[model samples]
Target: MARMLEISKLTIRNFFCLREFEISFQNRGLVLISGPNGSGKSSIYEAILWCLFNRTARQSRVDDVVNDIVKKDCQVIIDGYLNGKPLKVSRFRKHSVAGNDLVVVYDGENFKGSPSEIQLQLEKLVRADFNQFLLISSFIPERIRTFAAATPAQRLAILGGILDLHHFDMAYEYTRSRLKQYQVELASLEKEISVIERNLEGIKADIDYLERNKAKKKEEAEEEKHQLVLEKRRLIYRIKQVQKELERFQKGKAVDYEAEERKLKEERNELSSKLTQINGKLHSLRQQYHDLQQIEAKDYIGKPCPVCERPISKNLVHRLMQDHKRKMSVVSRQIKTAEEEKEEIENRINELQKRIEYLATEKLSQEKARIQYENELSNLRDKLSFVQNKIDSIEKDISTYDNLLKKRYKDLKKNRKEIDKLIEKQNELNHKIELYEIIKEMFGKKGIRFEYIRQVLQKLEEETQKILYVLSSSKLDLEIEVNNKEEIEIKVYRTGIKKRYEDCSSGEKHRIECALAFGLNRMARSFHLMSTNFLFLDELFDRALDVEGQEKVFEILQQMEREIETVFVVSHRPELQSQFSNVVVMRG
Candidate 1:
């Protein structure tokens, strides 16, 4: 019923006047925070505000937030719930620096960002800001007159903020910002679309041009390829012919001219040697014939007597002559035979010389013809290789053209797909721009936000009157008026007599402000859909309200225990402690 906000725990260290403090507010109600001056009674609630919004009731800077005596960094940790979800916040401020740090965990997630951003996130979850907390959920003596003392326009604005109407302003601005972003994106997409269109046109022209040249180049390559193929065939034929001619030249038994000449020269030398031996033998035989004719057996008989010193007989001489004649006849026949054999050998040697000369001439002519045929064959093969290389080059050119055509087609297809995607993105951006425009109008001040304020203004007036009556023991009634311009003026009535807020006594004014704050807190929870559950009255009982007035205020706040889980009453009065079921005491 109280929007489910609960501060279950608060821990403070070296913050403000308190050196170290911790308390649990779980299941607490109507708590009395009693302490002497500078005992940090108000600091308890200030710590909560500082943890939630990085602001305090006192007009102090960040450097002064740390305890003066401790001279240490200030830290505040708060564990709570927002809309029934767990919330934890830790705030820190260094004594020597002007920077304040914040960390938040909401619904089991650590809120991420800078200190300022985390503060905004916490404010968003609680549906309240520092001003709203001061005006609605808290009644600090220092800020008590802020709302009532403001001008009509300022008061209207302040009430609107307490009712959580600034969220509409943020939404309107965010929507307008989104709309501008979409418009810019759409413009950029249109430019992309235009560039893509031009590219597509260029691509089409390129494809057309390639297509025209493609056939012409292919035809030229085919013709050249055909001519090369024919040339290669002609070279092949010529090579085959030359090879056949070369084979014919090689088809002879290899001649060894040196061996033939050696054999002929050896045969001639042998025959000449035989002729000389025959001539020598013939001369010896002739010499023997001449000696036999010149000297008969008489000389041989005398020479034998001289050699042997023996007598020669007439009969022995006659017999020796007959033997010499027989020897001479055999020698003459051997001479004739040697002369005929020498003539035959000389004729064979002359025939061998003529054969060797003919062999030398034939070998020379054959070698020249073989060399000519080999040279012709080598030339034909080189021509054939050159023609084959030309054919291969032409084929490669044809393949290159085909690959180029394929790549061009791929480019054309890719460009077309890119154009389609751009068109789709353009449509999506246009629709988003249209939707954001409608949202912008809806979140404007005079739109749904205006209607909500109108209805809440009535409920706020009624609730304030109710609370004021209870707080004043039916002696005080409150009326809230709103002009056409949304300016507010609070009117108070005492027993049916109208009294101006400025004219009321201090006690009456405090009661009226308290009533108004309570009404706004209730309206914020119920009508504005904000989550809240705590109310802080810092020295509200000690300032101007008498004992009876304090009792009335306490009684009404006690009644609020059913809705608000925690209500902190900061006071130094000892008599007030007996009235509360829960008492938290702080000492300086």
Candidate 2:
């Protein structure tokens, strides 16, 4: 059997709409917290919510809770007893940051750890957060008004919260994420193994080629190098013979190729110097012409000519203009003539360069016989180097192929073992994937997600209908069930056909809301979520309710007291003040 919690006292200071407020709730039957509209009735429950959950029923920001009149630190103090043992929960703002606030909890008169730690203990004791507490212990009439207006997902989420099966949705999402991660890892491993297999294939081909040719290749290379050495010795003898004859011939047949090249270079340099001087003179004359033209264009009227520094009259301006134009024409012709000469000089220099190159080529032609003999000598040396390299390479291959193939075969064997292990792991992961797919189907569809939930819900439907029948004692029976799409549907079954919650009248909807709210409270109390006791109604009787609907709500309240320890009904109405046995009046 579970123990019931009894809250004895609550104190608030500078919380929203509450400044220096305190109230006590005894462990008994219905206790009404009655007041007018602005009498801080809602703040009473909000303070209790803040004490237990570190938040308010409205989910207001931390900064919004500090009463505008107080301008001071906010606090909520709740002292209670759990199964006759003393317990206290207090929360107060210490600094601006929301998480920086402090929460202290006491068990049997001893204070515990930090805010977060104390919150964990408090949650264990209460078994409900702020929203869950409201759903189970509190009545909010806006739910009936807004049910048809909420989106399908939002409606489903609301039903899920009441059903207390939202954790299954979170679990499904987590499992799917893990399955995706495993698949990614398997793909990466497969890619890595493929690269290893390719390397193994290349290594095997090299090993086979070296193994088939090693001994025979070594013998053939040694014989070939011996023959190459004999030919090299004969070529060396011939090279010395050719050099002796060539040196004797060069001593008598000399040509001065450098002196002729130097004369051609001197002629090219003189032409280049003349061309540079002409370009410089042409540039200077062109700039003077431009200066005079700018001076003439600006109307030069009663202004001094910029170039001559003389006072300008009409006649003087005309003369300056004609002079400038004549000078400009002369400079342009000079520039064109200079450009022509520069081209001629460039061509002459190119011709001289070609002539010098021709002389060099002629000298090279004269030494062709010597070059031919040297080339023959170089060819013999290269052939010797090639043969020697062939002999060395074959020896190295014989030694290295044995060591390399041994190492490669060892690596190949190791890779095969690793591949076997990966295959085993892959098989296990495949089995896991199959299980996860089934889980996805169960969690995603109505197959098992609703199957396990249906048992609890079917019993709940009977319980709700029983409570509704006891309240009205009429032929109308309520049905609450999840459809094939896993959506929660609420209906009334009075006639042969069924009617949805949306089609019901305002009063009938109010009655349904009462039944569902009481049933939820019933669920929470039975499951030890709402202290196994009383219910709290926040302005439910003040809504647009007819006399019959109000009577039905009172009946639900009567049921609350009989089923639990104590109940609270928060209302602003004056006529219903005498209905409750215990009442605590609130002041604005």
Scored by lDDT, the top model is: 1
Error of 1 at 424 (Å): 4.0
For candidate 1, the 10 contiguous residues with the lowest summed lDDT are 249-258
TM-score of 1: 0.60
Error of 1 at 301 (Å): 16
Candidate 1: C-alpha lDDT: 0.78
- Model 2: per-residue Cα lDDT over 1-588, one tens digit each: 556667787789888777878766766577778888877888887787777787876778877777877666788777777767777766776434443455554564444677787777777766665666776667776763454335444656675666566667876887788788778877877787787778778777876876676657667766776776676577667767766756754664333666677788788788778868867876776676676557653486777868787867888768767877887788778777777877888888789889978977876875786677667667756765676666566567666867777887787788778877877887877788788878877776565667865665676676677667755556567876667766666667655468766777666666666666667566655653446344677877756577766776677677667776667788888777887777788777
Per-residue lDDT of 6 in model 1: 76
The sequence of per-residue lDDT tens digits that candidate 1 reaches over residues 179-237 is 99999999999999999899888878877887777788889988998888888888888
